[model samples]
Target: MNAFAPTRTSWRPRSLRWQVMAAVIAINLCAALAALVVIIANARRATEIEMLSSLAIGARFVQETVERIADEQGGTASLAQLPLHINGLRHVRIRIEDAQGNGIDLAPASHDEADGDADEVPDWFTALITVPPAERDIPVVENGRRIGEVRVAGEASDEIAEVWEDMTSLAVLALIVNIAILAALYLVLGRLLRPLKTLSQGLQELEEGRFDHRLPPPAFRELALLAERFNALGAALRLARDDNRRLNERLVQVQDDERRQIASELHDELGPCLFGLRANLESLERMTAYAPVASAAERVATMVDILDRIQGLNRRLLRRIRPMSLGHVPFAAVIADLVADFEAHSAGRRFDFVSEGLAEHYGDSIEITVFRCVQETVTNALRHGGARHISIELRHDAASGMLKMAVSDDGSGMRANALPGLGLIGIEERIGALGGRWHIGSTDPKGTRIDILIPLPPANVQAESAERTVIQ
Candidate 1:
């Protein structure tokens, strides 16, 4: 019941191209993230493999030097010399321990060496190994017994750190590249789909019963063909619309003509007959005033009154079909007659008719249209609106060649959202037939108001027609 709410038609779309584009961007973004994840995992694996291989090579070299030094006689300095000889390595940490797990030397033997007990390696440094080394009991092999374990080790921390930094940098670069590519793709898609968007809007209009909208020619050949087909379809729909409108107009015109003809026949022919019969009956009643049977005369008088009532009903019916003639009557006279008729029929309800602005300079069709609009509006107000008072105003502007008529009532008015019924529909059709505008329904102060505006014929045209009529 709220006045601000619009009527819900069944033809509107819920989403447009912008929504689709956003969805596309989201899908592309997700795909880019997944691809980036896969690349980062592969890069990490490759880096780990390379680091492991490099460390293994360095460990073998250290082990060979340690075993060679052990082969020499009391050559503890040989294993210490291997640290400076291990070239092409950075931040290398080397450890040499004896059979009793006592450190012979540490490559990082300065104050910055990892904190540890005098003979044990730091827990953090040893934890870097993928697996812990096994312990042994025998000093030399005796029937499957082991002597000692030679541990040669290098740290993969720096290399792993370098690979992680490089991987992060590459991921950022890939994301920037993906974003630029997605933006370019989005623009290209938008440009290509622009014609489809226009076509969709046109179709939406057509679905809403606005069949006049035609799609513009598209850039693509196939789409251009589709646009042409749609244009042709719109043209055909317009033609159908015009045909239907003309058909309805013709039907209305025929009905109006039939009503006028019937009213004319009943009024000009049968009306007189009934009046003559009633007059003859009245004459009989008067002539038999002194009859011998007074009861018979009284019955004849009753029949005479009934005949007069029938004649009156027939006359009212004729007026209902077509108003009283205004052929030789001026505009004011016609309005006065109409107001008198309405007042008489309205059972004491007050009705007023007022006029202003060059009432003498009006056309027949304009005058009739205005009068009928007022008459019908007032009748409806009395019948359904429970109106106590009604006003009819007719105004003309001679300078502008505009004529306006308004009928207003203080009554139970119509709702703003309510549509026209049969009476209002007929009024609109008549006004349209005269090439005028018709407005109907409730006023702001709680009443029905029907305003009509019709353009008057140009003075030159009227003068030319008058000259022709004079020549004829």
Candidate 2:
């Protein structure tokens, strides 16, 4: 396994809005639980107090009735009537018992009769709020002897039931209120965070090299400040990019001017000198052939041959420096001559040149850039790719004011991990400086293909008749 290979990992991102909502829900639930605990505790204390108060009041009423019964001479018989008088009392029960252990028990009335159709309190809640029982006994007497006793006992089920009802109502109301608050918060958060989406789009444009794209100001103060900074940065980047393009264009122009100057010097200064030398060698060869000097004619012929080869080398070097007929002749014809020269030099290789809607000339920069690109790509295809057949296509669309060129070769495709060489880098730099685009990819069945598109000025959009030339 290669250590440099990229590693893949799965990631799941949580949403900020939902995370905030989850935190709110957790806090609310904890608060509600704490409130319930406090309410139940307070309810238990209140129930105990109420039970104790009812027991105290019932004991006082029973003591008074027993004294009255003793005074009226009814004795135990009146004690039985005491239970009837306190039968409907709240939070307490009344009972009467005699010396023989015989007793009358009076239980509290049923809770359902008052709270109709209400749910019964849960056992857990009832246990939490139940108060301890309280009981008091009042003695009954006749003629200074005790006869019977009245019993007053506290009960808290009714009070506990009322507390349960109140708790249920409060819980339902709180649930509804919390749900409404959460809904409102969701909408508010969405509106507040909307500027982030716009920022994301602006970042994508920057990644694609659109340094001139600017972000709009957001309503939020912090986000609006961010947008202002982003716009300023974009402006700075656009200026830097424009400056770089201008610099590259100036460099290319200077280089081309130097090449033209060098080509002119070679043509004017060296062409005649070599011509004169060759003429002298040829005349001396003919003169030696008649005079029959020993080996003089053979040596003269060799010198002539050497001069011819040197002239040929000089001409080829001049063409490579600068094509003399570039701006003077048709652009298609110049390209045709370039392809023909390559085909003539490369044995058993086929070359094709096709032109459609080409103008007489584009600007010097565009023409030279295109020519250099073609030269570099074709050379790379032959030297590195081992290509046998190379095709060049040039098309001009007058309506769009665009020029398109495609160069394809039946050669070994580029390696997947191969970095581009200096030639390709130069081609890209030249094309990018002119606000053009280029793509290189694998062709069908195993080959390399490069496509280029350059925008032309409206004045250079003149259309010429279509032509096709194939060199084998």
Candidate 3:
């Protein structure tokens, strides 16, 4: 009723523990308030009843005393002089008057004094327990003549003091009980929440790639089921990761095997045939130097020139078939050789090459992939796109365990909606099979730029140890 009432809209705590605690306190407070209302109501009623009974007794006492005194004093006793101070002096105030309603002065009515100390309770609590006073009046008579009226105003100071004392004791006991119960609840909640803490730690471990982590079943049925499900999911993820790792390894192995076979075929079969052709052409050109026929000499010279071109082409093809030089020599040397050969053949197109992080050699699979990708992209830029200027950038991000390459050509770029050639398609498949990605940056009239990104296994895990063992 005063300034200490709770807001109509109550606030709630965010944390689970605080939320539960706040809820319990609110419910208990409401119950305590309700009991307080009932006690105050009953106390008010009882006080009014007791006060009325006292006032009735006081009125009768006054009337009888006045009649007795008048009989002894010749029926002329003053109502004020009839021991009026003896009536209603301790509790309620009483006024006496004659038939003409004349006033008879009596003792003063006592003012209310808050009992058991108002400050002991909260403002809201004190306001809630305040009670209205009771008032009554009774008729007084003497010798069959109306003498006066006795008016009573019940002040609840005494009764309220008693109620306040009872409520204060009850409040203290309620507070003690509430605190004990809250402490017990906190202990129980801590034990009950242990399984949740375990679950949280298990989740963090799973995120860190510890898929083998398993949580023990909890005491609660719901938590036990959750643990079981989490274990199952972790098992599934571990299995999937193993399968993916094995699959990528198999693909890399197959790719290397195919390259080895092709290199073997070119060296054993194609190498000898080309050598014999060059020898025959040299012999024919020498005989033409001795022959007198001008036409015959010209024909032989033409054959020699054709043989030289074929030999150059064969050497280039061998470099493509087997980049074994990269295994024995620095990767930069092999790259330099390839660039020189390309520049010799295509004097019209200019090629720009930039490379970093290639000083240390990787496994054969890694080297071959890089060499072939560069070779084919440059060839396409010149042979297919007729590019005049081509730029190639090769960068290895050791920190990220990735290799990045960008090739752009200033050529009449492939027309829109045109299908990519076999060269482009083969590169895409090769990179994808190695778990890498590729993008055709642009294919407009200005130029075509191809971007390639390959994730490398960590340097320590590049399978170079197996290659070293094979060599030994």
Candidate 4:
């Protein structure tokens, strides 16, 4: 048998922890993005409204000043005397064009700081916070004809710089808040899910027949309910396991007792009776021979033949009921004996046995399960499949700790639609009891094969446990 080891693959299934964390982070990121969009949009709209209001109010003030100054006693000469621009401000550019077309310019600084101020923040942030510029014109007239024009537009370098600062601060604050919220969410989820980890480990151990793992009471309502349920489940399993162990023990005891009784009856009650009958027949045959009675002698020989046949039938029945020698012989040696016996009993029928990398030893339960499965399959093949030749192969995979045995017959093979009979069902139950599995192999003119695989525990764990056995 070639090594049937499975190749290891790289992809691993995601666990509950990572899945939950991913979902949490994904949801938080989406919420943060939505909030950011809304906040920036609202702030930008508010900035535009405020900038437009500043422009409107500044225009009204300029219009009122031009009208008031031109009406002064000095008239147009005094118009130049008025301070049209504020100190230390370069954003608001004030220009007055007189009726003579001469332009008067008033700016605290010559250079427009709004156009080329040192970049306060990144271009993207500045652009996001800036509002569209607004301009308004007011015509100044002394009486009826227009004297001069006062134009006002909002241009605040300090305002744009201040907006840039506010935006940067808002972004930093939002980032810190999002980080804090996500971090807290991560920690809270980890803490809340702590019980799940413990519960998972406990369930795994429970599945492996370790029923002692228990969960303590949790403070949270949902977790506490889950913990209580888990603990209860463990307790139920432990109770069921103990009960099953007792039942199995009693069943085993009864089976062993029946075997002993049958063996004793076959040996003590039937042995002497068959011996006496054989002795009586031998005496009669000798007496007939001495008397020269041919007919009598033939009858006596026929009687002796009948007696021998009965004894042979009895022994066969006993072997079928309980192969007590199976317990005494080596497991591998017993299989070799089975092949020899099958070939010896039937003419023109062959039984071939082969093994590959099989351990020289195993627990008694393993021995029993292997032997019974082979025996039943072989019987089914000969009796039902009309098999004349059978082949058996045994293998033990060290890496996987599994014992694999295959039994096949070169015969009519099994029908596809045929349901399993008593023997096959018995085989299935036997293997299941040992926590093993079996496969009914292919059909047709090819052959019939029955394969059984049993996982072997560590060498230290023997069949000493009461539950580690089969009744048959």
How many clashes (backbone N, Cα, C below 3 Å) per candidate?
0, 0, 0, 0
Best by TM-score: 4
* Residue 424 CA displacement from its true place in model 2, Å: 27
Worst lDDT run of 10 residues, candidate 2, spans 3-12
Q: Tell me the tens digit of each residue's lDDT in model 3 across 222-283.
A: 88999999999999989988977766776677578657866876677566656766665776
TM-score against native, each model: 0.44, 0.52, 0.47, 0.52
Worst 10 residues of 3 by lDDT: 463-472
Over 1-472, each residue of candidate 2 has an lDDT whose tens digit, in order, gives 5543432211125566877887899999999999999999899999999999989997888787676656666443365666656566677777788766579776535334433422488888878998779899877765667777878898787788888889999999999999999999999889877778788899899889999898888888999999999999889888999977876786687678668967776677567657766776766767775856755656566667757666766666767778887899988888888888888789999888888888888979899989989998999999999999999998888778889999999999899999987678779988998999999999999899999999997687766554554544
lDDT of 2 at 409: 96
lDDT of 2 at 147: 72
Candidate 2 clashing pairs, residues 3+ apart or interchain: none
Query: Candidate 1 regions off by >4 Å?
Result: 1-21, 32-52, 67-77, 87-93, 97-151, 196-213, 220-233, 282-472
Indicate the TM-score of model 1.
0.44
Off by over 4 Å in 2: 1-12, 74-77, 107-119, 142-147, 209-213, 261-472
Distance (Å) between predicted and true CA of 136, model 3?
A: 3.9
- Tens-digit lDDT track for model 4 on 162-228? 6666656877887888779778877887888888888888899898988988888877899999999
lDDT of 2 at 121: 81
